[model samples]
Target: MDCLISVDGSVTVSLLKSIFFIINVLFYLNYILKNNIKKMNTEPLNLVNGKIMTLNESFPIVESLTIKNGQYYSLNNPHPNFKTINLNGAFVIPGFIDAHFHIKNLGQRLDMVDLKGTKSAEEIENLIYNKSKTLKSGEWIEGFGWDQNLWNDKNFPSSELLNKTIQNNPVYLTRIDGHSAWINNVAAKVSNFDLSTNIEGGSIVNDCILIDNAMDPIRNSMPKPNKDSTKKWLLSGAQYAAERGITNVHDAWQSPEIIESIIELVQENNFPIKCYGMIGGSFKDFLVDFFAKGQYSGKQYKLRSVKAFIDGALGSRGAALHEPYHDDHCNCGLILISKEEFDELASLCYDNNFQLCTHAIGDRGNSFVLDTYQKYLKAQNDRRWRIEHAQMLTTNDIGRLKECSIIASMQPSHCTSDMKWMKSRIGEHRLHRISRWKTLLDNGIVIAGGSDCPIEEGNPLHEFYAAITRTDHDGFPKGGWQSQEKLSRIEALNLFTKGAAIAEFSENNRGMIEVGYEADLSILSNDIMTIESEKILKTDVIATIVNGNIVYGNKNF
Candidate 1:
């Protein structure tokens, strides 16, 4: 007999004992693992009597949800750990995320003079004049948010006038779009420039303003905020965003120093909002090796992406268009970087697991970016190569965005803010393709709604209102700018919540409300899904919660 092969007749006593031991250990491990998961499911942190959007296909919406520690724990399961409160039918949904914003710039702008909403050139001059009076000699007066499009005259102001008005100190006022800088003679001289100061991917418009990269001189000349100052500023910005129901943000542009400051925030547990930072494009070549990719979910700050500007903004006439601007016939707009350079950078980013989010705001610029994205990334791969602002696309490139599997990170409020003047820049013929959000969606491109914030109001509600209505604050144009392209309320909601999360690569954990998901939520004044489109604008964010803890609004509830 083959004694060694037959278990009953020839198996050694020691071998049988070892086999039994191994089976028992695996059985015990399986039992413990299942029990641990069951504990996660049953752990209680209750909130009852609510109208929740949920955003999960299975649950869709729920009246109650239970959370524990930092996660949802269970949906519809009675949680006994916390006191239950009746919400009186206040609508709750996944937390709003401004998918593209400058956290540091927002903080810095908080300290600068408010140049927004100025109707005339004289008002800006007077404001600068007043600001200069408070400052000592040789101090720089910095301001932002002035728009020539909103001015009745609609002309870029000359630096000669700006110099004469604020003669005591140097002045630098950035355009509403942040793509152009208006400087006084003092600043111009300090930066060493004149009307003929020519730089590619930017312009020295009227000798007073520096557009795009040309403003580098002024940027280098300015005093940088230290880590302490950055943390303070960022905290203020976080509180501000929390109040607005923004639970998360994509920090679109952070320098190397700024990136370290964020690390400090994470270490101290001081970062208030979920920060998905992009080491800004200018520092890409230098910082790529400095910041290795995807240290995802360090609790709050995750550097999983890179931001690049392909062109300046349309409002600044620097949005690299195929045709010259209707208003400015001679200029074809600015191309910030060559495609050859972008392709190599994108390849490196891809290998490093970083999402390459390129900001392209014109037809030509968007086309160029889409083409380059196609060149490096395969069609079927789940690479979320994004086009920030993707404001304009040619007829041929409409489906190309979907074919390349790109996410359109759009600022919905840009429609309302820019609609009044869009005709003058791109003309009515190209209007259909501008912010063709509906078109993009129909062809299967994910639209990640955002507010380029300091560029527009960071209110998630305002973004929702603009996206669905496609109208400005006063609700002009009767029906909407490109009424055909307007999105539904639920669609808009998903854009800010689910799409935003997906863009940040946190969709599985953060976007939806269900068991096993994090409890990041936004309670609204009314049910946005069923509310009137105009009432959507009136909808207020009642509360915001991040990681099962309330960050804004009533703590008692």
Candidate 2:
């Protein structure tokens, strides 16, 4: 009887093991079927007969590429079942990323009177006068992109002309750098701005011009754009960027409302380009709100950085320099934020793991930023804090950039735009310290290039040309201004690709054209790598693809 019972128990154990084995086999089959279904549902995109620049050292270039599931699937191997587009030997490279940009401002500028390319202040007045005829009485007549440096007189325009030109409308024209404003008597009266009022970190150049903090009162008096209008502006800016071959932009500054609008547009598929938003310090509560919410990392939009101003633009003599300006010997430029305030903000950002991007345009401003960064950040930490427009740096402070792991978020076009007056602003002695791209690179500091759009033309091709040549559109100064600082074609390309990616901590996924990276590409009319420098400006964007979908210039595809 005992022997019979033991044999029955062994048989029971064997039966249980057999059942478990069958369950395991079923689960494995189910997993395989699910993966196969997913693959079947995804429609891959393939590009053939193209000169694709991967920008990856491992696999530098390829002829054909495959995109599946919105990521690069293979290089030089077009999938047989995928939808294919014949490029006919088109030149393709990693999508351009504007490391520093102002999207909402760009949109607003589009609607305002375009003061760009106006030869003189009188021309600006004529344009404003024409725009005023269209608007109703007491309506604000806003204009931008006036550069006194470009004028023959090279002197700041007075409100005397605007006051006389337009009586019914209040005129407010912003300087090219957006740091100064030329307001008429009507605007001053409407905003109750007193000419004698002394403002900290700001200057009232005259009764008409207000620089840095001084422009705030007048700006606040103006009517704010409603939520709908803000959304419209954001869309307009994104569309404009797409047309210019920019797939990604590090939106330099944004209010909470603007950020919400961007997120809404992105979710609804209205935004065409990817944005890495920086919370603006101008909004008092942005940091608090941002900290509570933590960082946002959506597929098309990201928010993890804060933008604060250390000083103002060089054009207005508002950039804080170590010494008095060569032209204006009576004054050293203004400091918008104090060291105490900056350090406090830095601490908050450090604790919250938010990248701090400060607009430091002069040696003094850059020195303050670097010193503050050293206090909060460890040496060589991966925290890529940025100095937007590290336009000028003292010789001693150049090496401190690498030690603090700071990225120079420079706008290449700014160099060309400012080159005309750079010598006069800081004098010939400090000329080598301005826009030191090669010097910074040699010291192991990375540069993330951009357009600072609306201020400049905001064209990626223009930026590339400016970076390689260090010259304006007219190509003055013969062999390029500060020729030693000029970057190579590959270096300039990386500024908008790999270097830009590293600035935003997206280097692993977005910058390159390698397999497993996001399929963002810019197809150009000509190969910028091999073409003559001047011809680069003429090169048009054939196609701009984001997430494997053509967003701009799709007719070529």
Candidate 3:
């Protein structure tokens, strides 16, 4: 009886063990199969809101495009079971490229009192007076955006009158064009200048108003923005540009120190714009030292160009004209730097492989720069040097720009803005040949357009409108100023997009919408191609994307 019981218990335990093993294997296999199936059905995490993004070309039908790691690819037809957002058939184009901009300066001026719309000298004084009353006694009163052309007198305000408003503080005010400034006697003394300082290629009027290079001393003496303020300004400028659909900026002049600071901020994820900085003339030594330490590919913030000014602007009567100003006979404009200095700088740039962008506004200045560029190309056999703000050019000087392969970088709004007074300054015959984008294009010269912000606010729409219409914002003259010279919509687009990219020597990577290009694009709320030309300025930006990242957008949709 004992043997029988033992055998029966052992048999029961063995049966239970075999059944448990088989059940465990089945459960494991089922879990594995379910996990594999889930993995197989998973969709790649790539999606964007778009009914059908137009890349400056007509699309036959709606389609989804996938961007992975800054490269664009079309999705398979009748594609995946993944999530998607609808763009509602808005127009998408390459993000705008501002060839000339002052990012740091624009950023720093965000909090400064703006006097751009003040109609008269008295109005500006009154506004400054009220603002000064709040600041502590002795603190500097800094302001900007006063244009003498808008004032009743049409002349720069005297320092004596400016003193009445902010007499306790050392006040400094920049003109709207940034070519001139009004400084109190206190600032002049701090810079160790009275009425006798001989500022080369600049002037200090008897009333203590400084023009062109003369303002440099006082400006350099003023307090600079602290690191935090600098960062705030840069970020603000970037956000502002992005919101307006400007994805990239070619910063005209930046010091190496400022570049280093910006680079640090970018590494820490604080920067807001894709920037390419042209090191300032004053900081060539700093750039050289840094470049010697290491050569950069400009993957973050580019530092590959050197910016030098050959002359001042036309509004200040300092532009280097071939003939004396029609209004101011005593001046033929100012030759800011000597030819020897120019040749030395050119040679240095050629050796260093750094591109040069010289500011040449007056006819004489343009001639000299073009001559210098020709000489440099003959010596070095390279032709990427650009002339910034080719605002005015003599017929003789125009042909040389094409021969030397020098790019004529310009601002369209300047032509319209100066049209009112430019003739008065240069005479109708001399000024009639102004801007001449069509002339340059006809001669096979590449013209790149920009806003030169802080000089003129960096608005690409305003630039495009100016280019196509050649009229004031109000649609004046029933036709346009030099209407014959106006650019077609496509031509204007090329200047702002592809031409600008070519100026920076990055044409292959950006400036168009196509596969294998960086995913930098802008979406517009209105169809620019079909919108009325007069209403183009009213067009709004729906989104701005950079490197496949949605940096800015309206977000309402």
Give the alpha-carbon lDDT of every model.
0.80, 0.86, 0.75
Question: What does candidate 3's lDDT look like per residue over 125-206, in tens digits?
Answer: 8877888888987778778888888777777776667765566777788887778887777777666776577888788875
In model 3, the number of clashes is 0
TM-scores, in order shown?
0.90, 0.91, 0.87
> In terms of TM-score, how similar is model 2 to the real structure?
0.91
- How are the candidates ranked when ordered by TM-score, highest leading? 2, 1, 3
lDDT of 1 by residue, 320-356 (tens): 9999999999988999997778887788787777788
Task: Give the count of colliding residue pairs in each prediction.
Answer: 0, 0, 0
Off by over 4 Å in 2: 1-42
Lowest-sum lDDT 10-residue window in model 3:
36-45
Candidate 1 backbone collisions, by pair: none
Best by lDDT: 2
lDDT of 2 by residue, 463-497 (tens): 99998999877888878898999999999999999
Q: Is 1 or 2 the stronger prediction by TM-score?
A: 2
Which regions of candidate 3 are displaced past 4 Å?
A: 1-64, 75-83, 291-295, 378-382
